[model samples]
Target: MYQPEEIRILIVDDEPSILKFLSLGLRNEGYQVMTAEDGLSGVNAAQEFEPHIVILDVMMPGMDGYEVCKLLKDIGNVAIIMLTAKDEVEDRVKGLNLGADDYMSKPFSFQELLARIQARIRNQFPHMMGDVQVGPFRIDDRRKEIRYEQRVLSLSATEYELLKYMVVNHGLVLSKATILDKVWGYDFGGQENIVEVYVRSIREKLEDREHQLIRTIRGAGYRVDLP
Candidate 1:
């Protein structure tokens, strides 16, 4: 499992007290936390810091949460939890439509927010959480290891990441570009064929010579399905 210290959180709010309160609380929980006073700064920090989750306030002075949420979704893979003093259902729907993963009205309990963060981490990035099972493969995130039918599979660092990414997103026919962008970061200098090479290596280690575990889609990328 990923330790809390490995998870980065970005909190953006106009209120100084709210920022301080959340920063201290999340820090105490062992999360790597960063704060921004407004929507613009939050977007800037997300680009530089590349936080896993963004805690955004809806009613900011300029470039409200809605706009910020749109821009953030365009930027990279990030889970957003919106905060608002408004408790209307319309407001919640609006946030969700714009790509916020979760929402919380003001005056929410700190414990509840903490729970939501954990939930998002599990739901959106299952590979980062604790043990996960897909088909006959079991992933131990804390140990950074994978076992197939109780037999440990030797995997290099990149192979481990690629396999975990595919396994966590089981049953999805991931495109080559998408896999490259997600596993190898957008900044990776290698060619897209690198994905094919890693897939071959992982398949060999999994003893999937028949290509049942990680199957390549014709004209698409690949998929891992539960049996």
Candidate 2:
């Protein structure tokens, strides 16, 4: 029942029920739907699908949603929505800290998914506005410019999103999942290698070099905190 909409979507969940249900429902709504059962595959599917949005399961076997999210975000320009059973604020905060675009709790309804998808579509068309300042980086939405130390940084669409997401979540020890969700959105299902690429790109673009900013959290993901 997939509609004729131009938007493509990816749904990642460990549960077959959730994945199939969402895929069916979303397709019926005029979107091209793809799915993945595990975090790693989800990343691969995302890249191939080139989805407009990614719906991620927070808890999954093999690498987990958080890690997948992080890797995905690192690549750039995808919208991520994290769905989870854990309703704790910490979990929510963790997802947000990682840079997910939105979140949903488990047992969510089809109607809710439709609504969320609609919103994601709406986001594709923007209302150009003022700049967003985070740390030393300045995002000029109007000019589509990024400045660090008065030096303009050139970026691809994905790179812009990656940097913006990181700066927005500064001071948070964001996991890859969180960053992926925030920057890439849930719709991107592809290899996690993209995240690494973008982070490296961002580091070269933003990091002062002398003072290390984007630091790896060992067991966690990445962080950009001021000293």
- Candidate 2 global lDDT: 0.75
Name the 10 consecutive residues with the lowest summed lDDT in model 2: 120-129
Q: 82, model 2: CA deviation in Å? A: 0.7
Residue pairs that clash (backbone atoms under 3 angstroms), model 1 = 1-141, 1-142
The runs of at least 3 residues in candidate 1 whose Cα sits more than 4 Å from the true structure, single-residue gaps closed, are 132-227
Clashes of each: 2, 32
Off by over 4 Å in 2: 1-4, 125-227
Best by TM-score: 1
For each candidate in turn, give its C-alpha RMSD to the true structure in angstroms. 7.9, 11.4
Give the TM-score comparing model 1 with the true structure, all chains together: 0.60
- Please give the lDDT score for candidate 1: 0.88
**What is the per-residue lDDT of model 1 for residues 5-88, given as tens digits with 9 covering 90 to 100?**
999999999999999999999999999999999999999999999999999999999889999999999999899999999999
After TM-score superposition, the amount by which residue 214's alpha carbon in candidate 2 deviates from its true location, in angstroms, is: 36
